[model samples]
Target: MDMDVRRAAELARIELTADEAERFGGQLGKILEYIDKLNSLDVSGVDAMAHANAVYDVTRPDESRPGFGLEKALRNAPRKTADQFIVTKVVE
Candidate 1:
């Protein structure tokens, strides 16, 4: 698990000093060792997600709903003309 700190720093767009690299190397070594330990777990007879317990709520039926009046709604607009909102040109 020899992680090239230089390449890691280059990919992350950061500079790592020698002291930092040494510290990171030790930390990464421990992490990889722990991962190797996890890989040795005996789960051949285990049922995956046997502890998971959750259920979705029943969805209600969809129905058509009445809407507000267009003319009354447009009456409150700051800028509206010809049944359309008067806005600035979006394209040049």
Candidate 2:
């Protein structure tokens, strides 16, 4: 288990202290044990689902609405051209 933990850490490019490796190894063992228990369960009758509860879109339908005009939108800009805000170039 400790070796497995160390290998996993190496693959992940993570540096774990001796204490952390020991702790994580024990936790990983417990997780694997739980997974084994789950695998033993008969799940042939259960349907796979993405979520535990039913999910549905609850959003309002899109509707066209008047937007803040360019003048109002650019009113707070520190620097602006006639029709657009002037910001420093982010990319070459």
Q: Pick the candidate with the highest lDDT.
A: 2
The runs of at least 3 residues in candidate 1 whose Cα sits more than 4 Å from the true structure, single-residue gaps closed, are: 41-92
Clashes of each: 0, 0
Model 2 per-residue lDDT tens digits across residues 1-92: 13499998999999999999999999998888777777788999899999988999898769988899998899899999978999899999
Report lDDT (CA) for all predictions.
Answer: 0.81, 0.88
Give a tens-digit lDDT track for model 1, residues 28-59.
87887778876778889887773467656787
Candidate 1, number of clashes? 0
